[model samples]
Target: MTIAPQRVVTLHYVLNDEQGAVLDDSRARSAPLEYLHGHDNIMAGLERALEGRQEGAELTVTLAPGDAYGLRNEALVQEVSRAAFPMADLTPGMRFQTPGDDGPQIVTILDVHGETVRIDTNHPLAGRTLHYRLEVLSVREANRAELVKGHPLSADVAASQVEDRKVP
Candidate 1:
C-alpha cells in the first residue's frame, strides 16, 4: 500500500552532501529508522517523496539548499572573544550549541586566533544541496499497539500480539 498520512513507516536512507560526502546513513550497522508519517520526523522533501510509495521501493531525490537546510547567510557568522567560551582548548571545526532567534542553534568554529574565535551560526549543510538515497523496507497496516504507541510496533512485539490473538 502507498504510504499515507498517520501511517507508521520504516525505511533506510543514505544522505550525502553536494561533494558526495556521507552525512548520515541508516545502513551503517544501525537499525532502520521508524516514524509516523506527517509528523515531521524526516526532511520535508523526503516526506513528500514517500507520500505515495509502497514497501520495498527505492528512490533517489535531490533537494535544493532552500528545501533542505537553507542558503547560508554571511550575517550569521560572528567573531567573539575566546573568553566567551569556557572550554580551555577551542579548536576550529568544533561545534557548539548557542541560543538563536528561534531556538538553540549549532555554531561551528571557523577559526581560532590568539584570543578571538570565529563561529558560524548557519547549519553545516546550509547553502549546499542535499542528495538522498532511500529504500522502503516494509510497509504494512499498523496494528492497535502501533496506533496506541503513535509509531510502528517492533517486529517482536507485533509477532507476540499475533500469537496472543491466535485461537487455541
Candidate 2:
C-alpha cells in the first residue's frame, strides 16, 4: 500500500548539508528511520517527498531552512553570567537542557569568557538547508499501539508524539 496517514514507513536515508558534508547516514548505523506518516513524526519536506511512494523507491529532495529546522531566532541567543552553569567543565559545543516557559529547552554553548557565557537555544541545524537521499525500505499499516503512540514500534527509534517534532 502507498504511504499515507497512520502508515509506518521505513527509510534508509543519507542526509547532507549545503556544503556537501554528510550529516547522517542511516546505512552506517544499519538502522533505517521509521515513523508514522501524517503524525508529525518528521519534517514536512520529508513526508511530502515520501507520500505515495512504494518500497524500493529512491529519490532525492532538498529542504529549505524553513521546511527543515526552521530559521534561527536571534532571541534564542543569550549571554548569561558564567554562574548560570555550575556543573562540569564548561566548553564550546556543550549542551544542556533546562525547564523553560514552553517546557524543556536545550541550550548549546557557543562561547565563554571570564564572566559571561554565550548560549543558543535554537536547534543545531537551524537555518541550514538539508539534502536527503531517500531509499524507501518498507511501508505498512501501523499497529494499533503504534498509531496510539503516534510513532513506530521500533525500539531503536521509540518516540512519543511530543518528542517527534520537525526533525530534519
Candidate 3:
C-alpha cells in the first residue's frame, strides 16, 4: 500500500544543507524514525514527497527554502536586553526559548553586544536548501494509540490499544 495521510510510516533519512554538510541523519541511530503522515510530525515538503510512496522505497528530495523552513526574515532578528535571559550565559550560537506573540519560540543568539543580545527567531535551517536521502522501511494503518499521540505507536502503546479493544 502507498503512504498516505494518517498512515504510519517508518523511514531512515539523512538531511544535509546546501553545502552538503550533514544536519541530521536517522541512519546513525538504532531505529528508523516513525511518524504519522500529514500530521506535521515532519516537514510538510518531506511529507508531501512521501505521499503515494510504498514501503522500502528509497528517494532523494531537495526542498527549497520556502518549501522547507522558509526564508529567513530580517524582521525576526532583534536585539534584546541581556537581562531577559537570566539563566543563560548568552553567547553566539546559543539557542534560547522566548515568549512571542504566537507563543514560545526558540531563538539563536547571532551576536552579543555588551548589554544587548542579538537573537534570530528564524529556524536554524531557514533560508537554506535542504537535501534529504530517505528510505521508507514500513507503512501501515495508524493504530488508535498512534492517532491519539499524533505519532507512531510504541510497542507498549500498541499492546494497550489491543487490550483496550478486547471484549470485557
Candidate number with greatest TM-score? 3
Please give, for residues 137-156, the per-residue lDDT of candidate 3 as tens digits.
99999877888788887888
For model 2, residues 65-131, the per-residue Cα lDDT tens digits are: 9999899999999999998888757999999888998767789999998888999999889999999
Tell me the lDDT of candidate 2: 0.89
Give all candidates' CA lDDT scores.
0.86, 0.89, 0.89
TM-score of 3: 0.88
**RMSD vs true structure, all candidates:** 4.8, 7.1, 2.1
Kindly give the number of clashing pairs for every candidate.
0, 0, 0
Give lDDT tens digits, candidate 1, residues 26-60: 98959888877776667788889998999999999
* TM-score for all models, in order of appearance: 0.78, 0.85, 0.88
Q: Is candidate 1 or candidate 3 better by lDDT?
A: 3
The order by descending TM-score is 3, 2, 1
